[model samples]
Target: MSAASRAGSLPANLQGLWADGLNPPWSADYHININIQMNYWPAEVTALSELHDPFFRYIERLLPHAERTAKKAYGCRGAVAHYTTNPWGHTALDGRIVYGLWPDGLAWSALHFWERFDYTRNLGFLRDRAFPILKACAAFTLDYLVKHPRTGKLVSGPSNSPENTYIAPSGERGWIVMGAAMSQSMAFAILSRCEQAAALLGVEPELRARCREAIANLQRLEIGSDGRLKEWPEEFPEAEPGHRHISHLFGLHPGYEIDVDETPALAAAARKALDHRLAHGGGHTGWSAAWITLFWARLGEGERAWQFFEKLLRDSTESNLFDTHPSGGGPIFQIDGNFGGTAALAEMLLQSHAGRLRFLPALPKAWPSGRVRNLRARGGAGVDIEWKDGQAVSATLRPETTGTHRLIAPQGQRIARIEANGKSVAWKDEGVRLARGVVYRIAFQPAG
Candidate 1:
């Protein structure tokens, strides 16, 4: 994938390097709704930060086209991109409103910029590149939202949850609605990050204020009476209970809005929603199963995540190890599942999304002993871990930048001691301050 994207004019699209025929599936275009984003999920965390450049450049190219779409289509400022785009920069809505009417594509795509900065802590990139795109995306979001008559919250609409549909309370099957969970979650992720980016760059106070207000007013994620996270603003029945998209759980995986520890209730709700989908025959596709793996990893369910990982391998993998999506006739190759599964493996080993670095957060019992090397963490650190009996015994940290960093032990364990260059070092339960050019090691105490 890196080779396909390296110094390329366009980023890796639907079929990274395997566009075989004249008319590839979905034209092998960039599906910003998820596919394109999934393509790079492991870039930062797998020590492949440079591989993200092509996607970043692609975003820059899409800006003008997206801006035109926002103004001409929605009469809004800034920019918006719908479901898919090609090398020619097609930011306009695609064929159907069911899948193409989404305006949060720009917002969702812009998150890559913030994520790059988050991993590298590159202030120059944050100021010059990420903030501009973030600000513009946030501006569009601010203008695009309307007050929901019932909840009185700022909500986006006339948009569907990617490719999923719901049955409205009035017995109407609809593709479009207000405040879809995925839309609201994407809006919140972009706006909150934009505000923080502005504060970091020390500019755009007015924009920052507007973002804060919108964030506060944006419709919150609702838990339905069914004990699942609501897909729409209301408890609407799903047209396909086993839909492959699972868009509502975006917050649990790619976005940090939902956390297992910080937001336990929402996390439980997300789990229930995922279980309900699986019960109704969800995760039937390769990419969807891979995404479920990520969700379970985030929720600290190693066994569940492993189950989906096996399912993805067993059901969705072709002879060449390529991920295959089931179609009318048979399964067709899709690049997203390959990438998403790679990311899921890395996520199970080390996760740094929730403001701290957690080692082996979801080590499945199937893997009783293992070791992984060169897993990158947020804050520009490289992590290596060795575990036995499904427990992390030791971890090595190599920091690229000198600073204080938060590190958590593996699940059901605690840090026994820390060493810098083989010498005991003072540390706190909260975090540790380290200097670059020194190697730090952490030994863990077994769970009682």
Candidate 2:
């Protein structure tokens, strides 16, 4: 996947570098709703940041076309891209309204920019490349959002949860509705990031203030009566109980709004939602199962994560190792699942999203001993870990910037020793502050 998305060229599409025939599946096009975005999920975490360049370039090229679509389609400011796009930068809505009318593509796609900046801590990239796109996305979201008549909270309307539908109480099957969980989550992600970027750059005071106020007024994720995260503003019956798309869990995985530690309640709701989906035969496809694997890893369910990972491999994989999406005729190749599985495996080993590097946060008992080398983390750090009996035994940390680094012992183990360039370094439960370009080695053992 990384090789397919070289810099100065188009990002990897559905077929990636290979197309089976002259008339490839979905024309091997860019699907912004999730497919295209999922293609790059492993780029930063798996130590392939350069592979993300083509996607960023693609987003940059999308600006002009997206701007026109935002105005012509919805008369909104800034920009909006719908569910699908192509190399020529077609930002217009395509296909049926159920799957095509979504206007949050630019917001979700722009998150790659923020993720890159967050991982690299590149001020120049954030300033010159990312913030502009983020700001534009925020601008469009602010203009697109409106106060819900009853709830009085800002909500996105006429947008479905990325191809999922619901049956209203009146027995009407509907795809478009107000305040879809995925839409709100995407809005919150983009707006909050924009505010952070503005604060970091010390520019766009008015835009920053608007974003802050809008965030305050945005509808929060709600827990349904069934203890699941509400997919829509109301408790409408799902058109398909086991729908393949679990867009409501977007905040839990790709977005950091929901966390197992910080927002335990929301995390629980998300877990219930996932359970409900899987109980109803969700994750029936390769990419969907791969996404579920990542979600389980994020929620720290190592066994469940491993189960889904295996399902992705056994049920959705071809003999040649290509991810296969079920079709009317037979299973067909799709590249997102391959990339998503790579990212999920990396997530199971090390996670750095929660303000600290968590070593093997979701190491499954099935894999009692393992080693991973050169897994990248956010905030410009790299990690290499070796573990036995599900406990981290030794690890190396390489920071590209000077700062106070925080490292969490895997599975509640204790750090027994720390060495920096063969010299003992003072440390505590949190971690040690280190200079850039220094190699830190840590040894861990089971606690008590």
Best by lDDT: 2
Candidate 1 regions exceeding 4 Å error are none
lDDT of each: 0.90, 0.91
How far does residue 148 in candidate 2 sit from its true spot (Å)? 1.3
lDDT of 2 by residue, 91-110 (tens): 99889999988998889999
Q: Write the per-residue lDDT of candidate 1 for residues 275-333, one digit (tens) a residue.
A: 99999999999999999999999998999999999999999999899999899978889
Superposed by TM-score, candidate 1 places the C-alpha of residue 310 at a distance from the truth, in angstroms, of 0.9
Per-residue error for 115 in candidate 2, Å, reads: 0.8
Q: Give the lowest summed-lDDT range of ten residues in model 2.
A: 427-436
